[model samples]
Structure formats: C-alpha cells, structure tokens
Target: MKQNLLGAIYLSLAASMWGGMYVISKYVLDFVPPLTLVWLRYIIAFVVLFAILKWLERKNENRAPIQKRDWFLLVWIGFIGYFASIALQFIGTKLSDAHTGSLITSATPAFIVFFARFLLKEKLTLRKICSVTLATIGVMTVIGWNINVGTYFWGSIILVGAAVTWALLSVYVKIASERFSSLTITTYAVLFALIFTTPFMLWELQSKDITYESSYVILGVLYLGIVSTAAAFFLWNKGLELMDAGIGSLFFFFQPLVGSFLGWLLLHEKLTFHFFIGGALILAGVLIVTLPTKSVENE
Candidate 1:
C-alpha cells in the first residue's frame, strides 16, 4: 500500500513536470531548434544524472554490473523511447498541427497498457479498461476532435508510431526494474540517448539559427534539462518500478490536464468549459486506478 502511494506520487509529479514542459519548450524553441534543444537537454540531464549516480555509489549504494542483455535493453530504451519517439514527435508536429499531435500521442497510455499485458503478462482488468477509456475521452475533450487527417496523414501515422515506441519504453523499463535500480536505469539509458542524438543535433545546427543571446532561452534550457528531463525521468522510472505498469500509465493523463492549465497560466491561453470538464474526468480516471480496491487487496 505504501509503495503504491509513493508510486502514485512519483508518477503524478513526473507527469505534471512534463505538462509544464510544453510551456517551457515553447519558449525555448524560439531560440533553439527542436532537435538541437533536445540534444542539449539530454547532455545536461546526463551530466546531472551521472553525478547523482556516482554520489549514490560513494554512499555505498553500489549497483550491480549490467549484463549484456540488459545493456541491449537499455540501448533499446534510449533509441526507441528517447531518440526515435521524440524525433518523430517533433517531425510529426511540424507536419501536422499541435492539436493533432497532442490528441494522437494521448493514446500512449493505452498502448502502454496493451504492451504491459503482452510483455509483462499483466492481467487486463475491467477497472483498467474503464480508466483508460475515461481518460482518453477526457483527453479528446480537452484537445478537441479537430484532426486534419487528409492533410496530415503521414504525420498522424508517425505520431502513432511515437506513441507505440514510448509505450514500449515504459513496459521495458518495468522489465528492467527487476534487475536494476531506477537511478541506474535512467542514468545509463539517458547516456545512450545523448550519444544517439548528437549527430542529429550537429546536422540541425547547420540549417537552424540559434539565439544564444537571450537570458530567457538560457534559463528555459536549464529548467528543461534539470527539472523536466533529469528529475522527471527518474521519477517516472521509479514510479513504474514500484507499481504495475498499466496503473502507472494512467497517470500520464495528468500531462495534458496540467499542460492545459499551464498554457492558460503562462502563455495567457484561454481556458474553456471543456478544460474543466475534461480535467475532472481525467482526475476521476486516475483515482479509479490509483485508489486501493477490495479486489486489488485480495489479489
């Protein structure tokens, strides 16, 4: 029970940070291109994570040596989840509209549930199904149904691919947690991601103009690298470590809810009736999965 509570807290915090990330990214992207910004974020995150990992080790929390299979798994997490999924998201959003990207990628939790069932052999309960349904509906309400499918067919497809890859990353992170500490997993996985993203960042630098003169851009990059990437990623991995992947996935609904709120707050975007309605439903869905149930206790 205590573990579940901690997991819930961690997941919620992680999702909330990511929700705020959209606002920060919007501000920072004005100066840095998407891929270049991502690369810098990873580099900063890797440094911070690696330092903490070393500090923990010195405090006698030494990690086990990773096996060859696990190394491959970590690389897969980095490549598919961090590099490929994020790249696809940027490209897809560029091609399509931001609304379509948000709407499509909101399906990530559903995909995570599916992958958890197959890969982790987790049982799919009625409660899980209901939670996902309600949350997905809430996301649709929040984002609206204004999809430009005819014009952005390929972008939509790529967004779907991004969703799938991220789901796979979540499930695999769960699998890896059996053998590794969340800190170790996150640190090493991010290292691999940084390596994979370097070439793309260099290529992007050639074509894109970067504004390094603005203090706002610098601060935004620092916030994204430290708060959103390092802390949020660790919290997410730790949360999944302590809970069922399917249940943890439901917490992802908080991202859109918080993002909408932050958009209104920071960006001065307008809030509508749909936002409140959708936020309530999303909260309810999370509670349905997160609260302890009699059946769950018995199991």
Candidate 2:
C-alpha cells in the first residue's frame, strides 16, 4: 500500500511536470520550431541522463551488461515514443491551444488502460472501465461544448495519434521494467530518439529561423529538456515499476489538472463551471482506480 502511494506520487509529479511543460513549450515554440525543439529536448535529456547512468554504472561494477533483446525493445520504444509520439504531441499543440492539447491528450490513460491489458496482461475490471468512461467525459466537458472536429481536424488527429503512441510506450515501458533498470532504459531510449530525430531536426532547421540569443528561450528549453523530459520520465518509469500499469495510469489524469491550472495562471485563461465539474469527475475516476475496494484490500 505504501509503495502504491509513493508510486502514485511519482507518476502524479511526472504528469504535473508535463502539464506545466505545455505552458513553457507554448512560449518556447515561438522561438523554436516544433521538431527542432523536440530534438533539442531529447539531446539535453540524453546527455544528462546518460552522464548519471554512467556514473551509477561506474559506482556499481557488478551491473550486468544489457541484453540484445532489451536493446531492440528500447530502440522500438524510442522510435515510437520520442520520435513519433512526442513529435506528434508538439505538432498537435502547435496547431491547437495548450488547453485543448491537454484536454484531448487527457484520453491517454484510457488508451493506456486498454494497451496495458493487451501488452501487460493487466486485468480489465469494471471499476477501471467506469473510471476511464467518467474521466473521458470529464475531459470532454473541460474542453467545453464547442468541440468541432472539422476546425482543428489535423491537430485533433495528431493528438489522438500521440495518445496512442504514448499508450504503447507506457505499456512497453512496463514490459522493459522486467529486465532493465529504468535509468538505463530511459537513457538509452532517449539516445535512440535523439538519433532518430536528428535528420528531422536538420530538415526543420532549413525552413525555420531559430533565435538562440534570448535568455528566456534558453531557460524554457532547459526546463523542457531537464525537468520535463529527463526527470519526469524517470519518475514516471519508477512509478510504473512499483504499481500496476492500469492503476498507475490514473495519475496521468493529473496532466489536465495541472495543465488547466497553468493555463489559467500563465495564459490568463478563464475557468468555468464546466472546468470544476469535469475536474471533479476526473478526480473521482482517479480515486476509483487508485483506491482498491474492500475485497481487493482483504485479498
């Protein structure tokens, strides 16, 4: 129970960091193109995490070498997660409002739940079903009634693709947890992502003008790279290692909660009755997923 609580905290913190990232990214996006920013983020994260991982390996000489199968898994995860998923996320957010991005991507946990069942053989309980349903509705409500798919058609589709890829990444992360340390897995996965993103970054740079002189831009990039990408990803993987994937995913709902708050604070976005109502439902869903029933506890 205690471990579960700690895992929840870790995952929630990760989600919160990512939520805040949208605000920071929105500002940085003005200076950096989407793919370039993503490439830079992975590059920074790779360096930081790799240095730490190397240090740890040096300290612990008994650490086993990585297996070939794990390398394949890690590469696959990076390709789908960083190369495709995050890129899609950035594109979606670039095309849409931060609030809409957060709300639409809030459905990630629902996809994670289903993916966990298939990939990790996680149980599909009635409680989980109800929780996902309620949380999805909450996301819709928070996005408000003016959700015309035709308007932000491409953006919406991209966000949905992001959700799917991220879901797949989460499930695979759980699978990888069985073999490798989260630190090693995260570091190498990010390295692979950097490798994959380099060409795209180069292509993007050809057409986009970059301004690296601004201190604010540097700070924003650092925040996205170190805090959101590196630290949050480690925390998220740690949380998944400690808890069931489906249950742990409830913490992902925190993204919208924090995103909404940051949106209001940073963008001067207005909060409505729908926000509160939807937030309540989202919270309730999280509770239902996290707080096991009496029967489960007894078992």
Candidate 3:
C-alpha cells in the first residue's frame, strides 16, 4: 500500500510535470526546430535517467533478474511512449497550434480506457466511461472542433497518432506491471527510447534546416530531456504501476489545463473563454470517473 501510494503521487507529479512542459515548449518553439528540439531533449533525458539509475544501483544491487518476457514489453514501451508519442507531439505542436495540439493530446485518457479494455482486458467501469464521455465533450468545447486550420492533409492524422501511441503505452504499462517492477520497465523503456531515437537525432541534426542561434533553444532541450522526459516518465510509470488505469488516468486530464495556463502565463498565448469552460468540463469529467462515490452504487 505504501508503494502504491508513492506510485500514485509519482504519477500525479509526473502528469503535472508533463502538463507544465507545454508552457515551456511553446516558448522554445520560436527558436527551435521540431526535430532538433526532439534530438536534444532525448539526449539529455537519456543521460539524466541513466545517471539516476546508476546512482541508485547500490540499492538495487541485489534485485532479482528481469524476466525474459518483460524485456520485449520494455522495448515496446520505448517505441510507443518515448519515441513515437514524444516525437510526434513535438512535431505536431510545431506544425499546428499548441492549443489545438493539446486539445488533441487530451484525448489520451479516453483512448487509454478503450485500449485497456481490449488489450489488457480491464473491466469497463461506468465511471471511466463517463469520464471519457465528459472529456470528449470538454475537448470538443476546447478546440471548437469547427475551426480547422492546417495543411488539412496529414497533419491532423499525425497529431491523432501521437495521442493514440501514448494511450497504447499507458495500457502496456498497466499490463506490464503484472510481470516487472514499474521503475525497471520505465527505465528500460527510456533507455531503449534513447537508443531508438539516437540515430534519428543524429540524422535529423545533419539534414534539417534549423535555427540554432538562441540559448533558449538549448535550455529548452535540456529541460525537456532531463526534467520532462526522464524524471517525469519514471514517476509516471511508477504511479501507473500502483494505480488503476481509470483512476490513474484522472491526472492526465490535468495536462491541457496546465498546458493552456502555462502557454498563457509564459508564452503570452491567449485563451478563449470557451477553452476555460472546456477545461472545466474535462476536469469535471475526470472527477466523475475517478471519484469514489455512492453514485456508482446508487446508479
């Protein structure tokens, strides 16, 4: 129970941290290219995670061997969580409005619940379903789904793909806990994500037409990699390992609200009133799903 509590706190902190990254990221985008930013961010995150793991190696020295079955799971999570989701998100924000990008990404909890049902065979609880429905309504309100401003070809698809990837990763983590330590799985995932993203990072640096004049870009990269990616994922997976998929995902609903506020506070971005209302609904929906209630019993 103690481990579970720690994990839950870690997950909430991780979720909040990830949510805050948006505000910072929007500021960085002006001076950085998407690919370059991703490259630098991952490099830093990789080093930080490895360093922390190594630093704590003394504690885990007598740890049991990781099961062979879990190795595949870790690699898969690396692909989805760290690389695919992170890269696409960075690119999507760069390609589209940060506001729109966040709205799309907020769809994650809904997707997670869906995937969890089929992939992990998690029971479809009413609270989770209601939470998903409320979040959808909130998202629709947030984005004004009526407003379509983009290449109108593949950009939206790519953004959706990023959300789906993260959702899948969430489900994978839920399933993987049955077989491995949450930290171990997350550790391997980040480690392998770095491995998978490294060559691409190098290749991207070589080929991309990018701006590299400002220190803010470098700072942003370091921040993204070290704080946002490395520390955040570790805590997040730990939380997920400890909590239920529906219950744990309640925190994810906080990302857009945090991101939007950060974008407003730091990036000087404007927020529509509708967005505030949408955000409120999302939170309300998440609450509806995760709250321990007699309503569930009454209904």
Candidate 4:
C-alpha cells in the first residue's frame, strides 16, 4: 500500500510537471522552433541525467551496465518518444490551445491500457475498461463536442499522433524496466533522442531565428529541460516500475487537471461548468483504475 501510494505521488508530480509544461513551452516556442526546442530540452536533460548516472555509478560499482541488446530498444524508444512525440506536442500546441493539447493527450491512458494488453500481456479487466472509457468521455466533455476541423484540424491530428507515440513509449518502458534500471533507461534514451534530434534542429535553424522576449524565457526553457524532461521522466518511469502500467497510467489524467488549472490561472482562461464536471469524472476514473478491488487483487 505504501509503495502504491508513493507511485501515485511520483506519477502525479510527473503529470503536473508536464501539464504546466505546456504554458512554458508555448512561451518558449515564440523564441525557439519546435524541433530546435525539443533538441535543446533533450540536450539539457541528457547532460543532467548523464551526470547523475555517472555519480551514482561511481558510488555503487556493483551495478551492471545496460546490455548490448537493449541499445536498440533504448534508441527506438528515444526516436518514438522524445524525438517524435514531444516534437509533435510542441508543434501541436503551437498551432492549437494548451487546453486542446492537454485534453487530446489525456487519451494516452486509454492507449496505454490497449498497448499494455499486447505488450505487457496485462489482463484487460472490466474495471480497467470502464476507467478508460469514463476518462475519455470526460476529456471529450472538457474539450466539447463541437468539431472545428476546418480551423485546427491538422493540429488535432498531430496531438493524436503525439498521444499514440507517448502511449507506445510508456508500454515499452514497462517492458524495458523488467531488465534495466529506470535511471539508466531514461539517461540513455534521452541521449539517443538528442542525437536523433540534432539534424532536425539544425534544419529548423536554417530558416528560423530565435529571439527571446525576456530573460524569463531562459527560465522557462530550463524548467522544461531539467525539471520536466529530466526529473519528471525519472519519476514517471520509477512510478511505472512500482505499479501496474494501467494503474500507473491512470495518473496521466492529472495532466489535464493541472494543465487546465494552470491555463486558467496563468492565461486567465475561464473556468466553466464543463471543467468541473469533466474533472470530477476524470478523478473518478483514476480512482477506479488505481484502487484495486478484490477481483483486481486476485488477478
């Protein structure tokens, strides 16, 4: 019970960081191109995570290094996760509202549940199904039923792409965790992501000039890099290792909650009835997924 509680806290913290990240990324995107910003974020995160890994290794000489076979998995995860998904998120959010990005990516837990079945061979129980269904309904309610495909069509599509890739990353991370430590996986995966993103960052720089509105933009970038990418990623992976992937993924709904709250607070967006209603449903869904019933425990 204590471990599960700790896992919930870690996942919640990670989700909150990512939720608040949209606002920071939106501001920073004014100065930095999407691919360039992603590259820079990974670069900063990689350096910090690598330094920590090195320090830890020095302290504990007995820890085993990652095997040769796992390199491919790490690289693949880096490519799909940080390089593709996060870049899509930046581009999507730049083109759409932060609330839209949060709502759309809120569907990630559903995809995680789906992928978990095949990838992790996790049983698809009725409670898990209902949890995902309820959360998805809540997301739709929060975002509204009206479709404006003519205006932000591509942005919505891109955000969906981001959600799918991120879900894939989560499931794969669980698979990888069976063999590798979370810190090792996160550091190396981010290093590979940085390597993959460099060329794209350079290409983006060819036509785009980065200009900061204020020194505060630097702070935003630092927060995105160190806190969001480095620390939050570690926390998220650690949380996943401590709990079932589906249960762990239920914490993702916290992203939309935090994102919506921050969006209202910082951007002065209105808090409507839908927000409260949807938020409640989302919370209920999370409780359903995380609070293991007698049947779930037996499974």
Candidate 5:
C-alpha cells in the first residue's frame, strides 16, 4: 500500500514536471534548435545522473556489473524512448499543430497499457480499460477537436509512432527494473541516448545558429536539463519500478492537465470551461486506478 502511494506520487511529480517542460522548451527552442536542445538536455542530465550513480556505487561498494543483454536493453530504451520519440514528437509537432500533437500523443498511456499486457503479461482488467477510456476522453476534451487531420496526416502518423515508442520504453523500463536499480537504468539509458543524439545535434548545427546571449534561454536550458530530464526521468522510472506499469501509466494524464494549468499561469493563456471539466475527469480516472478496491486487494 505504501509502495503504491509512493509510486503514484513519483509518477504524478514526473508527469507534472514534463508538463512544465513544454513551457520551458517553448522558450528555450527560440535560442536552440530542436535536435541540438535535445542533445544538450541529454548531456546535462547524463552528467548529473552519472555523478549520483557513482556516488551511490561508492556508498554501496558491492553492486553487480550489468550484463550484455541488459546493456542492449538500456541502449534500446535510450534509442527508442529518448532519441526517437522526442525527435518524432518535434518533427510531428512542427508539421502539424500543437493541438494535433497533444491530442495524438496523449494516447501514450493507452499504448502503455497494451505494451504492459503484451510484455509484462499483466491482465487487461475492466478497471484499466475504463480508466484509460475515461482519461483519453478527458485528454481529447482538454486538447479539443481542433485537429487539422487532412493537412497533417503524415505528422499525425509520426506522432502515433512517437506514442508507441514511448510506451515501449515504459514497459522495457519495467522489465529492466527486475535486474537493476531505477537509478542505474535511467543513468545508463540516458548515457546511451546522449550518444545517439550527438550526430543529430551536430547535423542540426550545420544549418542553425544557437543564441546564447539571453539569460532566460540559459536558465531555460538548465531547467530542462536538470529538472525535467534528470529528475523527472528518474522519478518516472522509480515509479514504474514500484507499481504495475498499467496502473502507474494512468498518472500520465497529469501531464496535460498540468500543462494546461501552467499555460494559463505562465503564458496568460485563457482557461476554458472544457479545461476544468476535462481536468476533473482526468483526475477521477487516475483515482479510479490508483485507489485500492476490494477486488484489487484480493488479487
């Protein structure tokens, strides 16, 4: 019970941080191009994560070496989750509108549910199905029906690919958790992602110049690297380690809700009636999955 609560807290915090990440990324992207910014974020996050991992290793002094298979899994996580999904997301959002990107990628948790069932062999409970449906509806409500589907068909497909890749990342993280600590998994996975993103960053630099003159841009980069990448990734992995991937995935709904709230707060965006209604449904869906029931307890 305590672990479930902790898992929920971790997942919620991670999702909320990612929600704010959009706002920070919006500001930072003006100075840094998409691929370059992703590369920088990974570099900073990897350094921080590596330092902490080393400190923990020293404190423990008896950690086992990671196996070859584990290394492959870690690399897969980095390539698919950090590099590919993020790149696809940026490209898709560039091609489509933000509304289409948000609406489509919001299906990530649903994909996670499917992946969890297939990879982890978790049962597809009625509760999970209903929760995902409710939360998905809430997300559509929050994002609205402002999609330019005919114009952005290819972008939408890429965003779907992004969602699938992210879901695979989540499930793979859970699988890896059986062998390594979440910290170790996150650190090593991010290290590999930094490696994968290097060429893209260099390629992007050939065409674009980064503006480093503004303090706001510097701070935004730092925040994205530290808070959103390092801290949030660790939190998310740790959360998934503690709970069933499907149940933990419902907390992802918090991302859109918090993003909407932050947009209203920081950018002075208007809050519509749909935001509150959708936000409530999202919260309710999370609660339905997270809160213990008699049947779940028996299982």
Candidate 6:
C-alpha cells in the first residue's frame, strides 16, 4: 500500500511486457501497414479499455470524476502520448534500423526523470542521476555516435522525437492524476488518440491500399495495437501515477534488450559487442533505478 515491492513488481512486470512488445510489433509488419496498424491499435484500445473500465466499475474500487484542467492535460496525453508518439515510433522504425529505433526510444525514462524534476516538482537524487547518466551513455553507444550512417540518421531523429513526446506524456499523466483517475486518463487517452489520428486514417485510406501484404504486416498491427498500445501504455500510465517516474521508466529498459535479441534471432541482424555491452548498461541502469536504496527504506 505504501508503493512497496508488490507495487514495484507489478509495475516492473508491466514494463517487461512492454519491453517484449517491440519484438511482437517488429514481427507483425507483414500483416498490417504502420499507419493503419496504429489506427487499429488505438481504435481497438479505445473500445476495449472503455468497456473494461466500465465493467471494472462494478468492483466499487475504481471510478471518479476528472476536473476540466485534468481533462485538458489528458486530452493532450492521448493525442501526444498515444497518437503522436505511436505514429512517430512506427514511422521511425519503418525507416530506421531496429537497433537505432530501440536505443533512441529508451530515452523515455530519462525524459520522465528530467521532466519530473523540472516540471512536476520532484526531487532528484544522486543514484538516479548516475543511472540516467549511464543509461544515456549506453543508448548513445548503440546509436553508434557516428552520424555518417545516412540510412539511420533521419529515422533516429524521429525516434528521438518519439521518445521525447512519450516522456512529456508520462510527466503530464503524473501531474494530471492528482485530480483524475488513472483509468479515466487511460481510457480518455486512447479515445483522444483515435480522434486525433482520424485525419491521418482518412488520408491513408485515400492514398494507399493497406494490405496484409506480408506476415510482418499482420503481426505488427495486432501486437502493437492490442498488446503494446492498449495494455502496455495503459499500465505504464497507471504505474507512473502510483510511483516515481524514474521507477516507472526503468521498465522501458526491457524494450531494447528484447528488441536486440529478437532482431538477432529473427531478423538475422548481427549481434555486435556494442549491442551487448550497451544493453547490459541499460538493463543495469533500469535495475538501479527500480531497486530500493537505503535512503528510500529509511525514509
């Protein structure tokens, strides 16, 4: 009840589920187009989560009124958090290497910790600072620190933008939940994402013929929309509302590790020394952030 191990374990598992999502998403591209896959994800999420929450209301433990100010923030969360980030991520992944996309996206936690301090009025600690530093270094290493790879440049930039947007959304959710239910926030976020992406959906339909042209297409859409978008994000915001942003974001570490493994096993990508060493640092950083220190327990 004090946001202890149970809470941490639950949130960590949720994050791990998300970490595994990239592999599923990367696998599903042959069955669905990126934009269409995004659309279906949010649309399905909107319906499923709304209905699930409604049914959950009977538990008499979950329900609330969200104030107008909170509503405004959540709307943006849905738009930016759900729609924009999701769209940009797939777009970036589409154009970039899986390794680059993953490394850049890991910045979500770093953003959360940064924004928590600067925008949400949270205190920073030395251990967290070091974790952030190490994670950043690890991510940069995976990015190759060499800009000459024209193939990965623009895509990496977009992925970085996606990471930033997601971090901002996490901060907004943390602040917004003070006056709103995390359930309401999650539900509304998906609904608003659906609304925001509708224009793109129309344009997509008008111009492109979205076919389940490849098995990759199908897997990408289903996994991203249903599991990653709906379950992962909903749980993420929930965990963030209940705990520190840094702790919540440490869950993101799984994404790159899972992605890298799957890429080598499935995508036939080479597993370089850089990938393993960088991944180890990122994973270690996540554990460092999530584990309770003496200061936390004594407090």
Supply the TM-score for candidate 4: 0.92
For model 1, how does the per-residue alpha-carbon lDDT over 1-299 read when each residue is reduced to its tens digit? 89999999999999999999999998888889988899889999999999998988888744577888889999998898888889899989888989999999999999999999999999898889999999999999988878887889999999999999999999999999999889988999899999999998999889998988778889999999999999999999999999999999999989999999999998999999999888888888888878887776432
Off by over 4 Å in 1: 296-299
Query: 1 or 3, which is superior by TM-score?
Result: 1
Give candidate 4's error at residue 297 in angstroms. Answer: 7.8
TM-score of each: 0.97, 0.92, 0.85, 0.92, 0.98, 0.83
What is candidate 3's lDDT per residue for 24-135, written digit by digit as tens? 7766767765666766676677777667666777677776676777688889999998889988886776677665776677778878878877887777887777778887
Q: Can you give the lDDT of residue 258 in candidate 6?
A: 62
For model 1 the local lDDT of residue 278 reads: 89
lDDT of 5 by residue, 165-253 (tens): 99999999999999999999999999999999999899989999999877999899989999999999999999999999999899988
Candidate 6 lowest-lDDT run of ten? 140-149
- Candidate 2: the clashing residue pairs are none
Tell me the whole-model lDDT of each prediction, alpha carbons only. 0.92, 0.86, 0.75, 0.85, 0.92, 0.74
Ranking by TM-score: 5, 1, 2, 4, 3, 6
- Point to the candidate with the largest TM-score: 5
* Lowest lDDT block of 10, candidate 2: 290-299
Worst ten-residue run, lDDT, model 1?
Answer: 290-299
Per-residue error for 255 in candidate 5, Å, reads 0.9
Q: Is candidate 2 or candidate 5 better by TM-score?
A: 5
